[model samples]
Target: MNQNRVQASEVAPRAGLADISILANASLTSVTGTDMTSNAQGNYDLALKYSGTGLASVGVADKKVLVYALPAELQGKVVGGATVDIDANLLPITPGDIPGVKVLFDALGVTINTLNAVLPIPSVVAAFNQLKTVQNLGAYQKTLPAVVSADGKTISVEFTQELSEYVHQAYVATFGSLRAAIDALQGGNVVTKPLIDGLKLAADKLFDVIELIASGGSDILDLALNGNILGDMNGTLHTTVSDPGAASATVKAGAINNALISADVLTAIEQEGEAVTLNFPTTAVNPIENYDVAAPVITQPVAGQTQVAGQVTLTQPIPDRTTFEAVVTLPDGSTKNVPLAADGTFVVDTGSLVDGQTISAKVVATNGTYTKDSPITTATVTAAPIENPIADYNVATPSVAPLTAGDPEITGQVTLNQPIPLGTTFEAVATLPDGSQLTGTVESDGTFKSAGVDQLAAGQTVTNG
Candidate 1:
């Protein structure tokens, strides 16, 4: 026998060998055949030769070196000859070849028959198809919930754990000491200066945030959440995570219960009853009850007034238990607190004030717990001008005229030693011998005429009255 180089195996004895079989298998499961040989057309042709066998028993037509050829890697394991078929393509085979052919046939889930059957071959192919739709997922969106009362006065917010964590991170980033303190606290360390400072800083930051949210809108909170949309009560989304949107959260403010107090300078008089009255406008939301209102205003002196005094009236009547005060800033800049009467009125003496000096005044109402003040008003001191009354006047002799008609008349002009005012009036009286008197008033041009005077003789005395 020729020395076999590939492997030394038993060659079938001519007495026992009835057919030829060939098997090709790789040691590794994957295809790593670097020495694969193929024809120019990319077809792998493998030839098998056998000799000196019971070839006639195997139904060999001629014993002159029978040869069989098959495709490399295409053929399966060798076994007893049997019928074989691949994708409707058949090969000459016997019952013994069925096992080896069934390996490839059964792997493709195809079937074959060894007796009186035409084989059908199956071809395998692979392909990749394009998808009809695709989707991209990114970070999740977040939102902070808040509620506002109907009156739009008070607003409350509940922070989520995620939001709280974010706030903590923000605090730590803003204050370096905060991070250390937090770490120490997490590590169960004792309180220290840094921890106290951190706590103060955190409180301040929290208060600032609260104030901002309370005073302004929640645009800041929305920004912190990195969400474009705010959630509404109706579950409507207002913003998007990546782009700006017109979504806003609803925050209804409740009616404010506290009193809305305000005051103004109503009347600032510098006359004999010099007084200032502060008026508070009417409020509907929060009534002016259970509260005191005060205002301080500067009152300037009137043209001829010398004293300053004031009063205040609230929209609501002052409670009986409330105490009122008027804080007066004197012309010398000294201040005095004077009690106010139940009528919300007060008076201040201006004797110490000089002419043209300004005084500041303010009124305050207090109920022990709550107090309100009016705006400041100024008052200036002034004195009335001096004047002397007229003492005497001159009366000219009366001219007697007989009335052409029914009654006798007396006519005369009254003159003053000192010029009296143009509008001043003087009276003239004429006494008759009968003890009756005739009187008349002076006219604008300084003439007086008495009507219905007693008839007198030419010499009868008609005295000027």
Candidate 2:
């Protein structure tokens, strides 16, 4: 016989939503009527009341977010034994209230619970043709407000509804395209190239989920109805991590990672950020369908490409690693095959290279394949790490000869002699007659590679390597 309280915000907007329609039909005076009750099944239901032209359009938001407990049917759910419902009738509006005002309420007494959203609240694919339009490209460039406002109130508990599978696919593809570049944004980590394809697959799998949400969100983000797209996203769960030995992991798409990212990851440049890891009770994570877009793709350059190093990129949605493959056809009709670096990247030394001849680039990746006719790149190679630029081995030795990233770029293996000073208990610095540089991460047994051995002073050799 206990009663729960639920209050609706008057001036709040949906979060992360850019464009939408609103439906306002009526207004309300007060929710003074008190009723103690059950749904005849003896279960408590949370009841809401409102009036005004708005009432006709105010569909309920999801009370139980994905990361949180179930809605009404599942245990540990928000409606936990209590039933929440909404009722409405016309009433004259006051000074602060409008012609159509809504009142959200909750009540309880029952025991069974399952998470069923009030509906209209939650839930993409691709084509190269659509890439031509600026508007089409901008469709996914929405800047969902970190927080939104409506009628004078801030919306805290909000979620994105009206998600499209096609759009989701597009976003995923785009992300996959940029998978290699993502490394530049996130803190340095050894990401296998395959993760890019996995992310796209994940994004594609979201179509089913998009359908589920689209079917139910009849009035969720309609601009004609609720003027603001932002929802009252209160008490929404964001992350889930589980022990590796669990039987299964029921990680949902919206399942958030409070530790890694939140609403912030939705960006183009992709600066330093975190990852969202989900956990389930099972040994492997069960897939929860969701929607996102697939980014574009650009093959490398051609032979006659004016001396500039050409590159390939992607934009995928999944966080798993992926492999990317590309083929280069030389001017003489010979083809040179290449694979992405450890983290889905590839590099070519164009230095001793020539131009003015037609060349082509071929790419076959996890998602699909792309071919560029007569593509061209240049012979503009940047300086690799400094080679043995250190001096004074007799007085003071250095930690590393060339101290920068992107050298020995593929293996990440380095070679450095004992940079120790006096050569007593510590290792001795190898002094070459020519005087160049050398060094990298030395393993327990004392073996490493120099950073920029590729571009070095002629005739300088390190005994360590």
Candidate 3:
């Protein structure tokens, strides 16, 4: 009842035929007497009675046939009317215990003999080894579990889904190597049509025997295993290949035509259902054409001169300006693109640059593949002018006055020696006899009015500051 351990009941109820017909090419008429019995080891033995004209014609000494092994889940339990389900999960025949496997393999060897006529192919020898690996059931038994009797008449078949896949891969590997060998021989023009055609038929026959064993003696080969088994190679083989003729080209200024790069085309040849590309040699062609582009000339913001108001204006006439754009480098070492006007002139605003700082400009032109830069044109940044408004203004002395309680204010006048800034103003301070000072204001009309001076005495002079 344990799932991992297969039971005798599981084996007996499922597959009842111990010896099944694996030689599908040989016609089988009937298989009867499915009296199956099992041991404690969960091994099932079936004494089947088989009747077939083709089976009798083989004259194989061993009468026992290959049989399918039940999967773990379908071992014991029987489902009524679900034969398809059982058939689908059944494993392939036990390769090691098949009665006439050697006989079947010998028959396949006969087919291989025709291919051996063209013997020097190393790949073909490799394919022969691969085919032999498929034939040696003992090699497969190393991985596939089997219980063979001492006399080799009874075999407890234990196979899984992997058997089908392993057999398929083996046969595919054989044909692939065989095809490679054939193509190599064909390329040398040594292999002929009759030889290749005979080899193809022989390959198919060998595949038929392997597939029958993989399918547990069934005539139906799985469609999954039938895909491009022979590499889909068909049609008449082409032995001789035509030589590819010479290639040609033309050169022009600044460009070369791409169509003339290759002088000849190497025709592809088909061998063993695959296309073989031939290597054809040709003379080398240089496609580069020699040429040169003239440098653009810079005309304005003359080199080594002060730029007006920190603005560097670069100018070029249409005839002299052939570049796409002009770049200006500022005193701070920053560069920016200067958009050229329709008249080919551009202005760079260096904005309030310090004294002795410089700005430079150059034209960049490209003719698709090559770029050229004209000689850099540079100019100095202009400095700001100094202002001295105080030096232009002058003030006159104030009037002497005797201090009286009733009238104590003094008046004064100021003069402008030259034009000064519009917002300029002047102030006056007077020291009386008491050592105290009186402060006064000056107007735009050059008039000065002082604060009250009630402490001033006779002969005390008031000085203007």
**Tens-place lDDT digits, model 2, residues 174-288:** 3332233222322222442233333334333433333333454323212222322122221212111112343321211121212122334222001211112222233322221
Q: State the lDDT of candidate 1 residue by residue for 89-153, as single tens digits.
A: 01112211123222332322211111102221111111000001121111112432333223322
**TM-scores of all candidate predictions against the true structure:** 0.23, 0.17, 0.23
Quickly count the clashes in candidate 3: 4
Tell me the tens digit of each residue's lDDT in model 3 across 353-385.
576676677766543344556567776654455
> Best to worst by lDDT, what's the order?
3, 1, 2
TM-score of 3: 0.23
Give the alpha-carbon lDDT of every model.
Answer: 0.36, 0.28, 0.38
Give all candidate RMSDs, comma-separated: 44.4, 34.2, 33.5
Per-candidate count of clashing residue pairs (backbone under 3 Å): 61, 129, 4
Name the better of 1 and 2 by lDDT: 1
